[model samples]
Target chain A: MDQFIKINSLKKVFGEGEDEVHAFGPVDISIKSGEFVSVLGPSGCGKSTLMLMMAGLLEPTSGEIYFDDKSVSGPKNDIGIMFQDNTLVPWRTVEGNIKLQLELRNLDISKYKDKIFNILKSVKLEDFAKRYPSELSGGMQQRAAFCQAMIHEPNTILLDEPLGKLDAMTREKIRSDIQNLWMINKPTVIFVTHSIEEAVQLSSRVILISPRPGIVDREINIDLPYPRDLSVKRSNKFFEYVHEIQEVFHEYGVI
Target chain B: MASSKNKLSGFLKWIASGWMLILFFVLFFLFWEYSIPLFDVPRYILPAPTEIVQKGSADIDKLIYYTGVTGLETIIGYAIAIILGLGFGIAISFSSILRRTLYPFFVSIEMTPKIAFAPLFISWFGFGLLPKVIIVVLVCFFPIVLNAILAFNSLSNELTLFHRSTGANPLKTFFKIRLPAAMPQCFVGFKYAAINATVGATIAEFIGSDQGLGFYISIVTGNMRPDLAFAGIFFLTLLGLSLFGFVTLMEKILIPWHISMKRINK
Candidate 1:
């Protein structure tokens, strides 16, 4: 597997001198091309900080990140990010929000209209193309946000607990939708989440980070087959994987 | 049939919500009309509402002309303030140095009695429409600039990061993300500015101008025609309401996606 993203001992510290706070790192991570990796940890563990550094949204206090052999300096066009909150501009309609990806890239909207419409249709938001974020349900908004992030068809996608605030049913549905999307697109994804089950379900590998000044404590391979559904979650195999990840947390005394 | 019944119910609901306000105004005005005579109050002290209405109707054309002048001053001043406010706001937001240098200056100006500037404006511009417009701009400019600063700074880190990650240039990010996200707050500033614009114009006219409702009121009151002064006041109220309503209507049209606007639309 080609290393699409390589993080070399990245560290982030806030403030200076006496007031300094260690955010995360001296952490190293490498993600393969077309791989889905989840960073799971306890709250305030700087999992999100790690993800941000990977996305080039946050500057590492010290260290380097490489994307496809090129050092990541700043936000790259080929990277997509979705935050925990669906940060859809409130004033834009569903279609408009999706179109923002194309607009930002200065891509021809007329050429991509069909592509956008198709994405909306696939997400079951075709009827809500004209509706605003405020008019949509939490799940629908998250779906719209997912569409927004994926619209430009970035090679690498970084998600910061995108489904953390959603209800269980909605979360499961979006998680599955994400899986189906990943299966189709095969983009390298670095998803940050606190949910062990979510990490187990979605990622090809799970990177567990220890609480605060977070370090990559463990990496667990899901070894699950593709096209996973709710039934797989019920199976003993899924529980075993979940249990295995939970035990890593138990070792850290985090759970 | 169902549609018509729904319309009827909607109308009934509207009336139900508004009846108290209507009743309060009516009873209050009736008391004013009767109490003036009962208490033997002179006309110049407190004219009856009927007397004021009669005086207003008699001078309707003159009143309308003054109303138009004041309205124009308010609208034009507000428009200028909107442009300048947004410009200054963006400038301040774009650079921390400028924000630090200019924020206190703006705060001091805002804190200073706006009326204190009235005489200086009249002296510089000489009691013309220009002075009144300047006053309106001065009065209305602060809220817009302040609110715009608030709006621009209020851009969420996630949204900015999303924009940046998509390769949006700073200019594109500002226009597409910052401006749109800040619109609801911008409208709030606009609403306050609109109302203040009217007050600004009227205050300028009260100090110096001779061709607005403010001037007309001064003249009528000096002439001991309290009824006509009351009529001028009535027109002023209308001007305030009209400007406020116009801004609110624009808000609805522009930011129907805003939660408050969305709820209203629903």
Candidate 2:
């Protein structure tokens, strides 16, 4: 497998002087093309900081990140991101939010209208194309946000705890939707989450990090089959993967 | 039948919301009209509502002309203030050095009573409409600049990050993200500026002007026509309310998606 992204001895330190705080790293990671990887850890473990750095949204205090052999100094057009909060503009409707992707790239809207609508339809939000963010339910808003991220059909996607605040049922539904979308598009994905089950279920490999001066403590390969669903989650093999990750957390005194 | 029922309910809702305000004013006026004579208070001390209305009707044409003049000055001055405030607010937000140097200067100007500058404006622009308009601009500009600064600065980092990650340029991020986010706060500044616009124009007229509701009031009160003075005040209140209502209407049109506006619609 070709290495699509490479992180070398990355580090981040926030503030200056007496108030200086160490956020993460002196760590390294490399992801193969079309691989689904999850960085799983406890809250405030700096998983989000790592994701932001990879997306080129934050400047690293040291080290470097490379995408497709090119050093990333700033945000790139080939990367799409979904934040933990939906962050949908309240003033924009569902369609407008998705269209933001095209607008930002200065793409021809007439050519992409059908493509935009198809993604909305796939997310079951076609009927709500005119509704504002305030009018939609939490799940619907999340779906709209997902569609916005996918509309550009980028080569890579970064998801920062996208389903963290959702209810159990909504989380499961969206999780499956994500799996289906990944299977179809096969974009290189970096998912951040605190839930052990979620990381194990979605990712082919999970990078576990410890909190407070966050660092990669362990890496576990799930070796799960493709086109995963809720049924796969119920298998004994899934339970073993979940248990293995839990034991690492126990080692770090996280649970 | 359904449409008719809907219309009926809408009418009932309108009346239900407004009846108390109407009743309160009617009862207060009645009490004022009856109590003044009962107490044997002199006309100059506190003229009856009826006397004020009669005087107002007698000078209706002149009152309307003066009200029109004041209203025009307020609107023109407010329009100029909005342009300047929004321009300066955006410019300062874009540069940290500008914000650090200019913000304190703006706050100092805002702190000084705008009324104190009335005579200086009169000296520069003379006793015509120019001084009144300048005063209105000075009074109304600060709220817009302050509110706009707050709005621009308070946009969530997550939102900006989302836009940046999408590879949006600074100009696109500004129009699609920053400007829309700043609107609610901008409207707050607009409301304050709208109200202050009236006070500024009136103060300027009072300092020195040949026409306007303020000048008319000064003349009436100086001539001992207390009832006419009350009439001028009534016209001024109308001017203030009309301008305020116009700002609210613009707010509804511009940002119906805002939470406050959405709640009101609901």
Q: Residue by residue across B1-266, what tens digits does model 2's lDDT show? A: 99999999999998899899989999999999999999998998789999999988999999999999999999999999999999999988888998989988998888999889999989998998888888999999999999989999998877888888777789888988899999999999999999899899988888899999999999988888889999999999999999899999999989889999978877
Give me the candidate number with maximum lDDT: 2
Worst lDDT window (10 residues) for model 2 chain A? A224-233
Indicate the residue-level lDDT of A173 in model 1: 89
Top candidate (TM-score): 2
Residue pairs with clashing backbones, model 1: none
lDDT of 2 at A201: 85
- Candidate 2 per-residue lDDT, tens place, A89-141, comes to 99999999888778887877899889888888887889999999999989889
Summing lDDT over every window of 10 consecutive residues in candidate 2 chain B, give the lowest-scoring window. B160-169
Candidate 1 on A16-91: residue-level lDDT in tens?
A: 9999999898888888999999999999889888888777788889999998899988877787889888778887
Local accuracy of candidate 1 as per-residue lDDT tens digits, B166-204: 787888888888888889888888988887887888888
Off by over 4 Å in 2: B1-9
Error of 1 at B169 (Å): 2.1
Q: Which residue pairs in candidate 2 have backbone atoms (N, alpha carbon, C) closer than 3 angstroms, thus clashing?
A: none
- Candidate DockQ values, in order, are 0.76, 0.75
Q: lDDT for each of the candidates?
A: 0.88, 0.90
| lDDT for A163 (candidate 2) | 95
Q: Model 1 - which docking category?
A: medium
